[model samples]
Each structure stands twice: as structure tokens, then as C-alpha cells.
Target: MFAPQSDRVALRFGDRSLTHASLAACAGSLARELTGLPRVAVWATPSLETCVAVVAALLAGVPAVPLNPKVGERELAHIVADSAPATVLAAPGVDLPAGLDSVPRRDVTLDGDDPGSFADPGDEAPALIVYTSGTTGSPKGVVLPRRALTSTLDAVAEAWQWTADDVLVHALPLFHVHGLILGVLGPLRRGGTLHHLGKFSTAGVVEALEGDGTMMFGVPTMYHRIAEEVGTTPALAAALGKARLLVSGSAALPVRDHERIATATGQRVVERYGMTETLMNTSVRADGDRRPGAVGVPLPGVEVRLVDDAGSVLDGAGPIGEIQVRGPNLFTEYLNRPDATAEAFAGGWFRTGDVGTRDADGYYRIVGRKATDIIKSGGYKIGAGEIENALLEHPGVREVAVTGEPDDDLGERIVAWVVAAGDAPPSSEELADHVARLLTPHKRPRVVRFVEALPRNDMGKVMKRALRT
Candidate 1:
């Protein structure tokens, strides 16, 4: 796939860069080592070695489990026991935690000639066994096939008007779907260039965009930082002004940051929606309206519908329903969990477990996860997303998370845990009125608690389960 860009730069990290030919040769060399392995675990740090390790496993047609370096020993042990990888691949001389000690290790050394022993695997073959970051229980291994990767990547390219001529830029972790699949493999598949910041920094992003970078992929937190900087940094504003597309995913980008960045750079960050089980189902098209909070329509060949809890597809707006999708983008199954695999699908559509609403124009807006973010107060179903977005607009609010606390009168009351901006904090009444005014009076947070920060996972998603009363 990257043959056309053989001599062109394909991957760049801190103080290191690799051409397409070099990447292919390196992965091919590692493939020779990976061949015939039942499965392999990659110590997936955000580095060139991690990328090369995954690529090498792909080349050798072995299913890989990308292990997050930050994950706890217990979880890591669970993954090791579940996946039962024959070997763990890591960067040279890096000491792996004791959790992975039982598994044999292989250094992902980038050398050796292209042995030409690897062949393209069938689409039915398992490609990756990614673990979910759910709050309820131990992480489940989502088994993804090659076709899911290809279909989603192709669909995104079509939606974004992406081409080999374009250069993609991002500074995200390699362990997740957003960064690894779209950030790394997408560029390789399209024969495009990728510039990794190694770690997200506004200055680094500006420097890349000032160079040959045409597109950027970021999370909400990254865009928030960029928005905070763009107003003061003329170089950043100018660099972003010249970029072709700015995409945000993994979580919802706040509307305030969206408008702030747009006002400064005239670039509306496009948002997309997907999960580990479903690679990608919907995205905002590059040629279409850059709606602030909307994730736009479904991607090509992917069918999405808003269905109420009763299992009937919804028609109009205002009624929040679970997002169900049917497409080739779905994972094959949950590893060794046939019950979960069966429970994930209803008829032909996969229950995404995400609550959302669709307008008459077919634009989709994510509410939140049904298990957590959907709050029932005063016999009304309210999404914490809209309320949180509204609260984020308040000048004194830096970060906010909305949850439903058990109430005697209303069954459940809205609660807001906020990280106040600066030293002076806004009164609970003021913040409540802010949300009430922006949305409806009922959506106002019934109770508010000020905090230093909300607990978050590696991907920057707030862990509501950890918030204290």
C-alpha cells in the first residue's frame, strides 16, 4: 500500500523518522521473527517501536494484543491470561512490568533485510484483540478482523477526501483505536505521511503544520489546549488556518473550544463517533457542514439507527435512544465470551450502548453512555453531555462532569462535579442557573460539588464511577 511513497517520509517521532521503504523493511524483518506465533502482545508505548511491532505482527498475519504501558498489573495479568500470547514484543532494553514476566519476550529490534516471507492474510483472520475500558468489570478483549480495519479506514478516507498527497498529524497514544488504527495504519494504507508529536504540545503541532502537515487528528483535551493557545499564539493560529482538516474523536469536543478555535483560526474541528467494538460508524464529512457537537451522518456502507429501549427505531428528534449500527466495521466477537458476543447484537444491528439523538436532517448528536451519562430526574431522561456542555460555557468553570445522584423526591437528581477556573469558584447556584439558562430549568444541576479534577482514563475520558458524593 505504501509502495508509491517508498522514499517519502512515512512515520516521524521524537528525534527519529522513517521512510515508507524503511518502515516496510523494518516490519518485514520483525515479521520474520513473529511468524507462526499464536498471538503476540505489544508493549504499546507511543513510539516508533510500538508502530513497527504492530505492523510486523500484521505482516506476519498474527493477532496482536496492544498492551497499554500504564495499565495496572492486575489488568495486565488478566489480559495476559485471557489472550495467552506466546510472546510479548517490546522496545530494546525496556524493562517490562512483572505482570508480563510469565510470557516470553522478544525485542522489536528494527533491522534485518526484507525476507519476503509474509503474505497478505484473509479478511476473516483475526487482526487485533483490543481490550475495552469499561468501568463495570474486567476489560473484555474485542476481536477485530482485517475487514473491519479496511472498511472503516476506506470509509473515513472517502468522508474526509483523504489522499496520499495529504500529511496527517497527531499526538495520541498508540494503545487505542483512535491513535493506532487511524493515526498509524491509516497513513500507511493511504500511502500518506504521518507526523507524531510524541507528546501533545501546541508548539509541536504548530511546527508540524507550518511544515508539510495538511491534516490533524486530536482528542477533546488536545483541541481545548490548542484553543487556549491559538488566541495568543499567532503562529499557531496561522498554522491551523492553513490546515486542510482538523478532526477530533475518542470523546466529544466541547462546543466552547470548537467555537474558540474556529473564531481564531476559522477551522471547525470535525468530530466522529465510534467505539472499540465498532471501529467507526459515523463521521462529519469534510465537504458537509462542520457542525459543532454533531458527529454527522453514518459512513458509507454503515447503517445507524436510534432505537428506544423497546427495540423500535425512533423517528423524530428530542427522543434519546441507543445507537444501533449494522456494518462491516464491527468486531468479530469478544474473546472467549460467546454470551457477550450474542448480547451485543439485536437482530442484525449491534447495540452500541451509547445514547444519542438524530435530527430530521440525519445529523447525530451523542448524549452519553446509557449506563452512566443518561440521568433520569423528575421523570425525565436527560443527557449529561448537553448539561455539561452548557456548564463548560461558564467563565468560572474549567471542567465539569454531570451524574445522577439518588434523590428521595425526584427518584434521581442531577449532580455536577466541577473544577473551577482559577482560584475563585462560581457559586453552585450560579453554575446551576448557567446550565438552566442555557438549556432548560430542569436540566440545572440539583447539587454541585467543586473539585480539583475529575478522574480520567488514559484516553482523557472522565471516569464517573470514581467521582465521590
Candidate 2:
């Protein structure tokens, strides 16, 4: 069995490297002091220290809720109120919420007694509470058991063939599952070294991968930017090609971005399908074909299917419907909302609330969310993802968000929020024309609004509701 890292480098940010033993010691110290509390809230930056805190909580058998350090007072208060954490551990220099006791992560010192107090948790005990996007309503926490994570880490390690010889250049934030489970836990479980980047700059990531780094994890937005940067320069693209696997998730990976990455750097991005609830369920196989739009077959022990509105299982890939998942990694329940938890499951499968179709080979192709983000216009259902993917193909478009704006004639009109890239920024008319040339008439954006940047939540997902506001 794999034990926690002891001698190898656990985290690397900027110029610093923290060894596994040191990271364990740091977490052990925090765990020792917090033995009285059942839960602790981790409000911190995406750093090596935050990674250590997570491990400490897990090994110490105290569930840790990693809060997005960027949220405002009201949002923080909501999370603190909902989770009811006994203590909040804030990164150094971050302000703490009212009525919450604070501990500066740096000030947490580890000694002999700290490590000695550690206890293994029951496999069925709740380990984490990652909240949903709350796009449709108030965000509810999804409770994951220790066994859920332990199983997920095992599946990912086996599927990816992770090893100490591998190096993961991770750019995603630790607050989310993609960064935490796929980036940190799975890698550490295999004794693989992690080169964690505090902030992503195309140059910085390129520099890190130039070393022994073998893999990378990023959100669609980050990969889009990296692809764009590489498109502008050839040598940089060549350097990026050195990494073996470039994985993306948290949102749909645009086919254009995938093609650009491969064309520029000769590295095919292995886009995976996963969420905060179930960790990683599907991935583009490293040794097999990297299909453009397909998030490859379900991982070991995961059962994926598409069902009609009536909750009846559908036949071979035809019409898209709700995607349901059943696996050992599935969340036990939504933290406090019993109704929502019950409603989320139909029969034995967890209703993903995501619309997708599975191909003959069982690879899943996500169409859009079942909720409001999906746009219906002129008797045709349009996916915001489809239009957004089209907008990303435009050379002058840096970032884009698509939303369904209510229309008088059409049920909903597609409006795009774009971050302009070039000297002659593409006007809404020009972008509309550009999209018109590539997509069906219905898929084109009716209006395009240029913006400094799209609003994103702590998990790096573009807050579509915020864009509409």
C-alpha cells in the first residue's frame, strides 16, 4: 500500500520546494491542535501551504472544507454559516470572517506530539463538503465520504499510471476537486512529485514543464490562453509539447482550443469530465485516441448512462438527455438539504443535471446543462457551450461567455460577452459575421459585448449568472 510522501518534494511554488515529510509535519501540527473540532474551514490562496493543510486534515481524520479565499464577506459568512466549522484557518494576510476563530497557516508549527495524535478516519465518514455553483439556486454542500475520495484517488492513479518518475505541473486552484483530487491527492498517492504553480503565466508554466514535469492540469480558460499564447509564438509551442498529458476540466473544453494546442505544441489535450461531487469520472485515455469532443469512457467502477425525462434508460446514442452517474465515488448526500439530495437521484443513478449523449463506445459527449444556462430559441435548443466554443475560435477573442437573453420574437437570443484580443477588436457585428461563417444561423451570437474579463468563481468556472447581471 502507498503511504504519504516522506522524502520526495511535496510542493513547488515559484522558487521554493517543500518536502513531503515537512508537509506532513506541518499538517500534523495543525491537526493536533484541532482534535477537538469535527471540521475546519480552509480559507487560503492556491499555495503549497494550502495543500499541506488538506493532507493534515485528512490524516488527522478532521474533515476540511477549502473555501475560496476570494469571496466577499457575505459569501464567506454564508459558507461559514452553512458548514458550521468550529475553526477557520486563513492564509497569512487574509482577513477572517466575523465570529470565526482564525489561525494563520504559517504560524501552524509541527512538533513530535502533533504527528503522534493523528488518527485514521472511518471509510464511510464525511471527508469534504464542496459546494455547487448555485447557478439555479442557493449553493448546497455536497458531502463526500473518506471512502469516496480514497476510491477516486485509486482509480485515477491506476488509470493514469502515475509514478514518482512523473511530475505534474498544476495551475488549477486547490479549492476545487480538479486541483485537489486529480492534481494533489492522486499524484501524492502514487508518490509522484507535484510542481504547483501559484499563478499561471504562459512563460512560468513553460519554464516548469521544461524540467522533469510530465503532466499538467488546467481549466478550459487557462488552456485557451496557453493555446493562444502558443499560436502567437512557435518556439514556445514547441517547449509546451514536452509535457505528455495536458488535462482540462471544470468546464467544457472547446474543440478549437484542443486543436490549437496540438497544432501549436504537438500535445493533444486530454479533456476529462468530472465535477466537485464525484471527483473524476471520465478522461481522454493517454495511450489511446484523443477524441476532440468525447470525454472518454467511464473510469474503472463508474457507470455512466443517459436517460429520458421519464427516468427510463435510453437506447444507443441518439437524443441527448440527462446524464446520470453511479459509482463508489458519488457523494453521499448534499450536506443539509434532504429534498435536494433526494431529488438529485432517480432510482440508483445520481442525476447529473447535465445533458449529454453517449456514443457506441460509451464515450460521453456533453451538450449543456439542464438548467437555465441552456438557451431555447425559435423551437431549437441552443447550447451556450456551442456558441462559446465558436467564439473562442475567433483570433481576436481572448475569453468569451454565452448567455440566453430573452427576446420578443425569438424565445431567447444568444448574447456573447467577449474579452477582445487584437489591435482592431472585433465588433459585435464582425464577431456575429465571423460566427455566422462557421456555425449554423441559429448558433451565431445575436449580440457580442466586449469586456475586460468575464466574472469567475473561486473554482475558475465562469459565473454565467454574473455575466447576465
Candidate 3:
């Protein structure tokens, strides 16, 4: 995939860099060693070694399971036992967790002669077995086939107008799909340059975009930080203004931050929607309108529909319902969980478990997850995302998460968990009124709790489940 641009720079980690020729040579050498393995586990730290290991596994036609470095002992143990990898790959001199001790380790080296071209692996072959966050129960290993990767990558490339000339920059972790698949492989498949920030900082963003960085991928938290300082930091705004595209994913970027950044830099941040099971379903097109709160239309070759509780497909643009998708972007199945895999699909369509609505222009706006973001209160089904976005517009609201709690009268009462901005925080009543005025009276928070900060996961998504507790 990276052969055409063999001489061009492909991957950069801090000061270290690798050309396409060098990366292919190293990965090809490693691929020779990985051949015929049932599956290999990659200690996916944000580094060049992790990138090479994954590419090598794919080249060898063996499934690669990316292990999060910060995984808990029990979760790690579960993944290790479930996948039962033949061996684990990591960088030299790194200490692996005790949970991975069961598997033999192989140290990846950059210096290696190319093994020459290899035969094409069939598209049906499994490429990566990515484990979900396991919020509902134990993490299920999601089996993503080669076709899914290629199709999703091609679809997104078409949506963003991405090409070899574009230089992508991001600081997302290597364990998940956003960072590994799109952030890493997307560039490689396009034969483009990818500069991975060892860590994310507004300063790092400025330095990168100010250089040759043409595009950026980040979550809402990162963009929120950028929005907070971009107005005051002229360099940041200037760098962003020079970029071709700024993309946000993993979570919804608040409308307030979108306006702030666009106002300061004259560049609107593009948001896309996807999950571990489905690589990418929708994205705001590069040539289309950059609407805030909307994730844009479904990508080419992918189909999306909204379904009601009765399993009836909802039509038109106004109704909010659970989103279902169908396309080559769908994952094959959950490893070792046939029942769960069957449960994930209905009538040939994958149940996304995410609730959303479409506009007249066919743009999709995510309301939140069906399990947590849908609030049934006062005989109305209100989406938590709209309320959260409304609350974010208030001056005193720094960060906020909206959830539904048990209520005798309303069935589920809307509650807001807020991280206030200034010394004088907005009162609960004031915040409630603010939401009611912006949205609807029924959507207003019946209860409000202020905190120093909202609990977030590694990807910067608000842990609404944690907040509910």
C-alpha cells in the first residue's frame, strides 16, 4: 500500500522519522517472523515500533490485537486469555504489564532488509481484533476484516479529499480505531505523511500545522483546549487557519467550541461519526457545509437509517431514533461471542446503539448513545446531547454532562453535572433556566452538581456512566 511513495517520509514520532521505503523494509522483515501465527498481540504505545508491528502483522496475513498500555490487570488478563495470541510484540527495553506475561515477547527492530513482495491476502481475512471499551461487560474482541479497513479508508479519503500530498497530525493513542486505523493507517494507505505528537498540546499543534501539517484529527477535549486559548494565542489561530482541514471525532465537539475556534481562526472543525464495530459511517464533507453539531451525511457506499423502539425504520428528517447502518464498513463479528455478535445485528443492518436525527439536507446529528443519552422525561423523549450543547453556551459553564436519573413524576429526571468556569459559578436554578430557555422546559435539569472537572476517558469522552453513579 505504501510502495508508490517509497522515498517520501511516512511516519514521524517526535524527532524520529521513517520514509516509506524504510518502514516497508522494516515491516516486511518483521512480517517474515510473524507469518503463520494465529494472532499476535501488539503493545500499542504511541510510537513508531507499534506502527511497524501492526503493518507487519497485516502484511503477514495474521490478525493483530492491539493491547492498551494503560489497561487494568483484570481487563488485560481477559483480553490476553480471550485472544490467546501466539506472541506479543513491543519496542526494545520496554516493560510489559504482568497480565501479558503468559505470552512470549518479540522485540521489533527498525534495521532489517526487505523480504521482497508478498502475495495479496484475501479481503475476507481478519486484519485486527480490536477489543471494545467493555463498558457493558467484559470487552468483546471486534474482528475487523481487510475489506472493512480498505473500504472505510477509501470512503473517508473520498469524503475528506485526502491524498498523498496531505500531511496529517494527531496525538491520539495507538490502541483504538481513531488513532490506529484512521490516524495511522489512513495516511499510510494514502501514501501520506503522519506526524504523531508524543503528547497533545496547543503548542505542539501550532508547531505542526505551522509546518507542513495539512490536516489534524482530535477529540472534543483537545479541541476544547484549543478553543479556550486560540483566541488569546494568535499563533495557534494562525496555524489552524493555514490548515486544510481540522477534524474531530470519538465524541461530539461542543457547538460553543466550534463557533469560538471558527471565529478566531476562520476554520471550521469537521466532525465524523463511527465506532469500533463500524470503522466510519458519516463525516462532514470537505466540499460541503461545515455545520456545527452535525456529523454530516453518511459516507459514500454506506447507508444509515433511524429506527424506533418498535424496530420500525423512521423516515424523513425530524424524528430522533436509534441509528442503524449497512455497508462494507461493518465488522465481521465479536470473537468468542457468537450470541453477542448475533445480537448486534438486526435484519442485515448493524444496530449502532447510537441515537441521532437527520436534517432536511441529509446531515446526521448524533443525540448521544441510546443506552445513556436518551432521556424519557415528562412523557417526552429528549436527547441529552442537545441539552448539554445548550448548557455549554452559558458563560459560567466550563464543562457539562447530561444524564437521566430516576424520578417519580417524570420517570427519568434530567440532571446536569457541570464543571464551572469562574469564581462565581452559576446556580442550579440559573443553569436550569438557561437550558430551558435555549431548549425546552422538559429538557431542563431538575438537579445540578458542580465539580472542579468532569471525569473523562483517555479519548476525552465524558464518562457519563461514571457521572451517573
Candidate topping lDDT? 3
For model 2, residues 1-469, the per-residue Cα lDDT tens digits are: 1356478886787787777677666777776776767788776567766776677777767778888655434345556778888766655566554435433233333332344445566888888887654444345688888888878878766666667778899776677677777778776777778888788778878778887788888776677677777898765686678887888776666777789888888788887787767777887677757888888878889888888888888879767888888999899888888898898887868887788988877778888777756665533445576567667878999999888876643546789999989867887887887666554465578888888988999999899888787
* Candidate 1 TM-score, C-alpha based: 0.80
Distance from true location, Cα of 449 in model 3, Å: 9.8
Q: List, residue by residue over 1-469, the lDDT tens digit for candidate 1.
A: 2334378888988678888888888888989888899999999988889988998898899999998776655567778999999999999988898888899998887675683656778887899999874433456899999999999999999999998888999987787788899999999989888899988888899899999999999877678788888999999999999999999886677788889899999888988998888988999999999989999999999999989888998988778999999999999999988998899899978998889999778999998776886665543446677678778889999999988876543446799999999889999999888876555576789999998889999999999899943
Q: Tell me the whole-model lDDT of each prediction, alpha carbons only.
A: 0.85, 0.73, 0.88
TM-score of model 2 vs. true structure: 0.78
The candidate 1 region of ten consecutive residues with least summed lDDT is 374-383
Model 3 ranges off by over 4 Å: 1-5, 373-469
* Candidate 3 residue lDDT tens string, 103-155: 99999999977846877789889999998743244568999999999999999
Off by over 4 Å in 2: 97-114, 374-469
Report the number of the highest-TM-score candidate: 3
The alpha-carbon lDDT assigned to residue 3 of candidate 2 equals 51
Given candidate 2, what's the lDDT at residue 394?
Answer: 85
Query: In terms of TM-score, which candidate is stronger, 2 or 3?
Result: 3
Give the range of the ten consecutive residues with the poorest summed lDDT in model 2: 104-113
Model 1: runs farther than 4 Å from truth?
A: 1-5, 115-117, 316-318, 373-469
- lDDT for 397 (candidate 1): 94
Write down the TM-score of every candidate: 0.80, 0.78, 0.81
